[model samples]
Target: MNRLTAVTLGVADLEASAGFYSGIFDTPPNRDHDGVCFFPLPGCWISLFPLGHLAEDISPEVPKTRSGFSGVTLAHNVKTKDEVIAVLERARAAGAAIVKEAQDTFWGGFSGYFADPDGYHWEVVWGPMFDFTDDGALLFGKG
Candidate 1:
């Protein structure tokens, strides 16, 4: 019960948004229904639904325009800086907005950022100072 089941994004057009995600993930939606598209992630799913419906489901007060920094980001951890570059390139090729090019950071890592069709920020990163288990779970300061 403690595990997250899904992370859903509010989108303007389900088809276009789903298409954009398909290209980014290099896979089609695991499930597509009348009003939503669902992509399976490692331990959860990413869902896309119409913005209006999402607003209604959550609360009518939810802001319609999600622009600028929404103070939220999604991240994918990689084992190397080359992997980071590869992911960013794929995202760009899939029509993502490359917000930041891969580069060494003061935190002793290499990373880049991209914005998906809905302007959700994602970071591809390689942190030599962090440890990752066989299943890719991250543990800090254990490099």
Candidate 2:
């Protein structure tokens, strides 16, 4: 069986990326080294690795370009609309770009988007139909 373990981001500077996420998430890195750092999230891990190292690990022939969305956006579900706003503010202060500010959505949720330094998108949301634990794990659902 294959299970998702971590979401690794390619960053221009590992230390800077680590600092950004550490501030926004309010958690220190589980492991930090010269070329990489790791943060353990609710049920997964987020890792920051140098861009050149990541490219070489994947494939030396891979092309590098900063264009278009990567079709992947991480989501952080909070308990209240106020939390949504607060988190967005923290993210913005940590140098994340506000791709979309928090607002009520048609899907019965309040959500927003932010992009990390490398352009990876994240959606911070609050859904009335779901409950999340303090550790950021989903505890209940409407269904």
Among these predictions, the greatest TM-score belongs to 2
- C-alpha TM-score for every candidate: 0.85, 0.88
Question: lDDT tens string, model 2, 38-89?
Answer: 8888877888888888888889897544467989889887889999999999
Q: Tens-digit lDDT track for model 1 on 29-135?
A: 96637888998865668899988898888888887656678899988788888989999998998889999999999988999999988889999989987777776
The per-prediction CA RMSD against the true structure, in angstroms, equals 2.2, 2.0
Looking at model 1, report the run of 10 residues with the lowest lDDT sum: 134-143
Can you tell me which runs of candidate 1 are displaced by over 4 Å? 133-143
Which portions of model 2 miss their true places by more than 4 Å?
32-34, 133-135
Cα deviation in Å at residue 71, candidate 2? 2.0
Error of 2 at 143 (Å): 6.7
Pairs that clash in candidate 2: none
lDDT score at residue 7, model 2, on the 0-100 scale = 88
